[model samples]
Target chain A: MQKDASLTTPAAIRKLVRAGDYSGHTSGFAPGFVQANLVILPKQYAFDFLQFSQANPKSCPIIATSHSPGVTDMPTVGEDIDIRSDLPRYRIFKNGQMVEEVTDISDVWRDDLVTFLIGCSFSFEEALIAAGLEIRNITEHKNVPMYVTNMPCQSAGMFHANMVVSMRPMKPADAIRAIQVCSRFPSVHGAPVHFGDPAAIGIKNINKPEFGDAVTIKNGEVPVFWACGVTPQIAIANAAPDFCITHSPGHMLITDIPNSRMAAL
Target chain B: MQKDASLTTPAAIRKLVRAGDYSGHTSGFAPGFVQANLVILPKQYAFDFLQFSQANPKSCPIIATSHSPGVTDMPTVGEDIDIRSDLPRYRIFKNGQMVEEVTDISDVWRDDLVTFLIGCSFSFEEALIAAGLEIRNITEHKNVPMYVTNMPCQSAGMFHANMVVSMRPMKPADAIRAIQVCSRFPSVHGAPVHFGDPAAIGIKNINKPEFGDAVTIKNGEVPVFWACGVTPQIAIANAAPDFCITHSPGHMLITDIPNSRMAAL
Candidate 1:
């Protein structure tokens, strides 16, 4: 919680991360701001990966991307969100295997790398909570349950995988309200992809999730599932890109853009 | 289908209805125009009813209201929509008892009357259908099944009733898409209030709807329920005002406003 001005502002948080003082997840650090999933790859695979994101928007909503290879500063999303070090934690991968976890990517930075900032669920979750809908995972203090689904993603070149989804249990009425609230933020997964029967999308057990801790599903509540940011990661790994870098799970690139700025309405 | 120009233009449809040539339900006429639920009340009850609409916006989304008592021509919604004769069918009620249904209300029109144009579901249904989601009621060629819910509406002075909801059957994915599409048209019912178990909303039997014919719920489909336009009528009936009128069910006032005009985005 090194939140000083850093806790309140995106640029300040990046400053702290750049100074090697913090290496933690960015959730709850800056209210009302956009937090993005970071993906970096050599320019060779950038074109195909961009196509994959554009083709499957709900799972991989692109907020901003580097205008050209080797550009480290994303001035559009934030004043100076240096891709090499702004994120507190980075995962380096080689040929699809995660090779190292580091506080900053400055040492691993390459001129041929292109960075992508994909919309994260934090934006929509903020929206739903603001609308007075109780988010079960937030209430239970756990990562929203994420599951791999039978629903396949449209592949682009070598990248291919099934769509992944994050689930939140809500009463039917609250779920409806959540849908309306989330729809406004199209960049942040928009509305849910599915709800009701989990097995319909190939989830076998409700209590256990593949990627995150499970929350209590109260009686009479149905699980609502949204396209998860993890879908692209899985697709990238399956592609076995020779070199890649990404923010560690929950440790996102905080941006100056407000969540409301992404709303369609 | 006296369409031609009249079939496509809302004002032209009003002209036909005014001349006593068309007196049927307005469905499928003026394809992309907005159709409104009509409610007329004496000046004395206007304040209370307006309060009711304000308090319960989801159920009673008031698109426009009479600027002043005795002004029948609503220039805002259309060029020349005469509340007295524009709608194909008008129901005359005295102390909450329906007296007669007629093509023209010119004879019964009162100088003290104020008209309210409420958003109808037709707008969102068009949007959903355009998005390729099946509306079960339309496929079944039946009125949307409506249920009386135990969910109580906020009451205004001399007006009170439990919320009434119209049900639509859709597969969960389609229902989620419907919610997003409908959310853009807040002037209509907006998003569904509930989906999944009917018992949650106090509807004892899903098959036995209180109003409108029941549409079949397929194996994977869930019943998505929206706050209904019928709500105002129930409130009006509870109020039991001495003089009142409403458009006969499905016989709406076709407005010059295009359906696309209602999208909040």
Candidate 2:
């Protein structure tokens, strides 16, 4: 998969994914644009998830949502985002367990299904890279390591779980600069949840992350952690409402909005 | 003695000081404007001091400086400002040792003296107060507690010294908010340098600070430390130039610019 050449534009990439031509990971695709973590739920659980996101904005910054329960086109984020088939892959869950992975969910899409577009780390990562900081996962060609921490997310209704965090190894100096840089982009998991020790957050092993591949931790680098998009997924898994769908890991929905537009400052 | 009533405007206060009518501290005076820390040096050392300030901006953010060697009017910060008599009191130092403290320095003014206006904590203190955060020094009617730290300032030319920091006791939650608030106003000794333990920065005694009066540190409150304007003063002391003049402690020059004008964001 030539990430640089194939996916230059969001609409062009979405067309390929919709046509079943491309179905691999979407990291490093559509540079300078916002990519989102997708969460599709039945109308019965949509209100609870929305409330959960509102309670924990730093962990779950909601970018946009479907206008109606069945409406798929999120006109605000991009031109024609068909929530059911635009993504590269979808994971179908039944009673909180993954049932199957499918290319399109049009067969299972119901009239009462709702789609949520949550802000992902790609935007802020681009900002950090632009500021001349090296991301360990990107450099090592591995997924950014993620861990489920003891820090619990504020529960709204039946939606509740402990927060999940993504880790990036950086020296203390770069970590300080990263804090200042990310503080400006509140919509994309602003600042960091914790910096230094892994045990402080109840992570027993720095090498064994709960999700994503472990990247190299250099000599002077401390693992800097940010509240991850996987948090809402964890909450959804806990709630487990009959049926739900989400993009397979790394198959994000790229939007037309540029990454810089997300900076709150 | 009535701080709120005595100093209504910058010009009026300058007039009173010029006529030898006011000779006290300017801490509570000029309620809603910028009050600066003054350091006057010979023309030979002006460029070096300016470079030091530029290198250590968090400690010494320069608001304005004398256009030339002996010119008095700092028309940029205030109008018709006689740097000799505008400040309440001036300390004349010969080879870095204090020789005299006088209400006016006109008779001793030289052609080679250069004036610098460094940003003081008063502006951000006002902002913190407006945000409903209590300033311990202001509440207790004492000078803000300051300490000499192991952290060394970037040296330039003959100017070099360990950094000085001012401490304010705040709960962890309040400290986080303070960091966010102070980040907006970069000129006025922005965001804290270190928070949790004083020993981390080599401050042996938290209760007994090196420079200013000690304030109460309540239960569950961690000492938040900011890079102090005294940093430049310490550098100047180390440099020990032939002669220098500076505003007496707490006797700053009240500038015409409003405090709100200093916020970078």
Candidate 3:
């Protein structure tokens, strides 16, 4: 879709997505607003997932959850946000496997489903860019490279899996500044987990990522890794839930909350 | 002297230093209080030095300055703080070179002298230790390794010199945590300026530091460097004023201010 001044507001962007007009990745729309990763599961698994999110906040920082099971509206993040159809796209998971990708899940919506709004890297990336640091993946026009690490998340009931992290390369000086800037917004992965060698965290290779395309790591640049929202999706798959839903990779749910409100300081 | 419970207070420690009963380094003394590096100069150079500090804050963070030239007391930082005798030891500089190391500078005191109190690493080191990160220099009983870097500071009038950085080695994860904790105390050199390769910041050998004893950089640990308070001393030496006084290396001015008061948050 062509970028325009009218599409700069979160309300406008979500209106487009809800009307089945813009179903692509919501990467650069509504610049100053927050965009979140979506996760929906049955009521039977809600308590365990909430506990898991609390335990591994860096990876699964929940911005808001459905007021109650069976509620289709998430009033906390945006006005009149329909949990079933507001996001541009979502993946339906059946028995630990993704069965279908669709623009809307209204047809499969169930009364007992619970929705969670998890924090995304886009918020901190905006803060970094505002602080005058270049985000490599954004500059290269690619999704952030992600890898599964040996670090295990605290298990909550049936949920258990190793952490998944997203990588961004920067000079050591820039990395220090990035840490300072990102530290202000703990809800969105906070500071980087590791910055130098990938092998220390169990990643076999820097160039080959398990998800998303690899960006260039310039000379003198170290690969800085942050806990990724994809981590929760891995845990859901490992649990083998009978029914689950998540925003398709890169297609996030735009929220009315301004990103600046997320700064802890 | 033995570190008795009574010496834990800054006032008690300063009383001993003031009486010439203790002329040794002040490390590990008055544990929870703020310690400051002292710089006394003629009124002629005060404005320029203040500008230099504003320009290079990370290196020469000013915690407090004398109310005016010739003022012997600093009511802002401590009670009855006699600028001439409160510090454990003072270094007298003549024509930019060290002339004498003495316990008291009252004999050479002049009405034209101005005193500056710069934040020292001791405050943030306490914070880092409290956060459960091991400081290699403290663990090994050595002064933090300081290096003269090629990075130039923004010059103000006659004051101009390269930045000096203090190094602490830690694993990547610990370095990230250190960055978060140190960012809270900007007055105490704040967060690290660089981490990982020492050569990236112009340090030729990690094992050899220009000032302070070197600590071991264990395997899997990266050396994190913070802007050092010693940077101002280098600037003073380069300026080559007619006369100046500074705290002796590792001997600081214990302040009435609690270290927690320095947190920017």
| lDDT against the true structure, each candidate | 0.91, 0.88, 0.94
What residue pairs clash in candidate 3, if any at all? Answer: none
> Per-residue error at A74 for model 1, in Å?
3.4
Instruction: Report the C-alpha lDDT of model 2 over A143-206, residue by residue, as the tens digit.
Output: 8999999998999888998989999988654765677788888888988877666877789999
Candidate number with greatest DockQ: 3
| lDDT of each residue in B95-165, candidate 3, tens digit only | 99999999999999999999999999999999999999999999999989999999999999999989999
Over 4 Å off in model 1, which ranges? A5-7, A79-82, B1-8, B79-81
Q: Rank the candidates by TM-score, best first.
A: 3, 1, 2
Deviation from native of the Cα of residue B76 in model 3, angstroms = 1.1
The candidate with the higher TM-score, 1 or 2, is 1
DockQ of each: 0.76, 0.22, 0.88
Query: Global lDDT for candidate 3?
Result: 0.94
lDDT tens digits, residue span A1-265, model 1: 6456636978888788888888888889889999999999999999999999999999999999999999899999998677888888999999999999998888888889999999999999999888998888888889999999999999999988899999999888788888888878889999899998999999988787899999898899999999999999999999989999999999999899999999987
A31-86 in candidate 3: lDDT tens per residue? 88999999999999999999999999999999999989899998888998887888
The TM-score leader among the candidates is 3
Question: How much native contact recovery, as a fraction, does model 2 achieve?
Answer: 0.00
Grade the docking of candidate 3: high
Instruction: Record all residue pairs in model 2 with backbone atoms less than 3 Å apart, i.e. clashing.
Output: none
